[model samples]
Target: MSITLKLAWKSLLNRKTTALLTILTVAISVILLMGVERIRTQAKSSFANTISGTDLIVGGRSGQVNLLLYSVFRIGNATNNIDWKSFEEFSNHRSVDWAIPISLGDSHRGFRVMGTNHSYFEHYQYGQKQHLSLAKGEEFDGLFETVIGSDVAKSLGYDIGTEIIIAHGISDVGFSRHENTPFKVVGILAPTGTPVDKTVHVSLEAIEAIHVGWESGANLGNEPSKEQLLQMDFQPKQITAMLIGLKSKIQTFALQRQINTYKQEPLSAILPGVALHELWGMMSVAETALLIVSVFVVVAGLMGMLSSLLTSLQERRREMAILRAMGARPRHVFTLLVSEATVLTSIGIICGIGGMYAMLAIAAPIITANYGINIALSGITSHEWMLLGFVQLAGVIIGFFPALRAYRQSLSDGMTIRI
Candidate 1:
């Protein structure tokens, strides 16, 4: 066995340039394959964990997908607003534990602005039921005070006490830029790799405060000063959505039914877990397509290796003939060829794993900061192990092609061949 390995090792070193190139091709393909796998698994986990510990997400009557997108992802506009009365009714219900109302339709330099009570900071949870923690300062206490996410703070270079003027709509050049009631950044939340990292959080009153005196999507009356707006009524009459936490899991369905059938207002209550699963399910097709592409890429890399082995076989015929002259049997030639393939593949897999870790080390933080997906620098998962196993098995299987060809060649043919 050692002799065979030594022969294979020296043989590969004979065509060191080709061997190196083959290994690189395999390494790149492995990196891509493992990267897609990592992103797929981590993305699903990231989505599922975006909001946790909350039982249900309540919003105006709309599709479950719509509510999830607008309320949680801040992706689109709300279909309509839910009356504050309805929020109070369900929030005060016997089975309800906590409710955090959400108000949108405002932006600060292109960042979505969210409005909620202090309960948001207390009750809202993320991955593994982790609560949002302040990285720099405390939650907003005043109407004009705001708590920015990590991305927002870093992107806009905002720190505590940094004043920001919000626009009326989602656009940077919105309907009305509230120049009078500029909000001061009070807190900066640590990066959670979720939508919270991209949001600007303020009190519900602050949402109302900036829009005071606005009518028909424009300021029809004189705008109130920041001080005056703070003192006056800022109580929200309607909200875009709310996150609900039930006292007991048993009553979740009952409460959902009750809210859906509410006569006062049409509303939709969706279990966050169920909705999240459905959301991820909708994206599965794309994920599967990406995975297929990666698999093909790996196949291409293996095919390249096969081509290298076959081409090298043509050039190494004389070498094989010499070995046979030295009493090395055809079986020995076969073993050596197979061992060469195995060694090349083993080295490639090693380099691929090393490349993968290096990539994760460099990209994890960037991905977390931009997309809010905290890809952990973890070890190979079971699925990745399966992928690696497939690669190893394929390599050994591919070895047979070259090994068999060399085994069948007669010593006379190999030695007499001049070309």
Candidate 2:
């Protein structure tokens, strides 16, 4: 075994460039495969953690999945708004444990602005029912005071006292500005790894205050400054969605049905887990496609390694004959070749894993900023470890073919040149 290993090392050294190139090819493919798997799994976990502890997400009449998408995930726009009266009714229900009203339809520099009541800080939870906590300053105390999400504060470089104006609509630009009403940043929430991290939260009254003076088609009149607008009434009459937690889990279905059949406003209530699962089912198709492509790439890389080994066999035959004359058996030659392949492939796998970690570390901020998805740098999961085992198995299987061919040739040649 030692002799075989020594020979394997020498042979790899002799064709260092070819061996290194093969390793690199396999390494890149492995990195991509592992990265895709990691991102897919982590993304699903992050999505699931977005609205933990909230039994049901109540909104205006729409598809249950759509409500979850628009309200919790910030993936789409709500088709309609739930009347404030209906939200109050739900909040005042006997089975209700907590209610957090949300008013959307505004953005500041591409970050969604969420207008919600102070109860949001108390009741809303994420990531295993972790309560929302302020990282700096206190929660919104006045209607004009804002509590920014972690991503918003970090990306915008805003501190506790920075003031911001909410846009009239969700447009990034070309919309009427709420020039008269600007909110002060009173607090910054800790990172929740959810859509909440990307939101700019303020009092629901702040949402109403921004749109009060400007009527539809009204020209941008010389409006009072933002400070003056703060002195005016800022009570809200409507909201985009509300999150409801029931005193008893059994009451969830009953309340959901009631919200869906409300007389005042057509509303929808969705079980967060069920809606998230449906969303993931749709997302899994893309994940599967990515996995397929990664498998193909890995196969191609293995084939490249095999082709390189086969092409080098001719040059290695003379060396093999010398070893055979030195009392090296054909079995030893076979073991040597297979071991070399295994070592090369294992190196590739290691490099691939290291590369993935480095890439994730570098791209974490960009991913969160652009897609609102947080890719955590947690240790490898069981599935990922299984993948590593599979890669090692594949390496051995692919290497066996070339090793067998080398063994056959060494045996048939009988220490004599056949060519």
What would the per-residue lDDT of candidate 2 be over residues 1-419, giving only the tens digit for each residue?
A: 57677778888988889999999999999999999998888788878888888988988788988999888887788989988888888899999999999988889888889989879999998888899999999998887789999989988999998988778666756456675566889999988778888899988877776776667624356556667766887567889999988899999888888877888878888999999899899888899999999989988998899888888887778777787778878888888889988988899999999999999999887887777778989898898999888887888888888889878875456556667
- Model 2 CA deviation exceeding 4 Å by range: 172-175, 217-234, 410-419
- Report the Cα lDDT for candidate 1: 0.90
Top candidate by TM-score: 1
- Residue 44 lDDT in model 1? 87
* TM-score computed on alpha carbons, candidate 2: 0.94
lDDT of 1 by residue, 237-301 (tens): 99999999989999999999998998988899998888888888899899999999999999999
C-alpha RMSD of each candidate structure in angstroms: 1.3, 2.0
Per candidate, the number of residue pairs that clash is: 1, 0
Candidate 2 lDDT for residue 207: 77
Question: What is the TM-score of each predicted model, taking all chains together?
Answer: 0.97, 0.94
Q: lDDT, candidate 1, residue 219?
A: 83
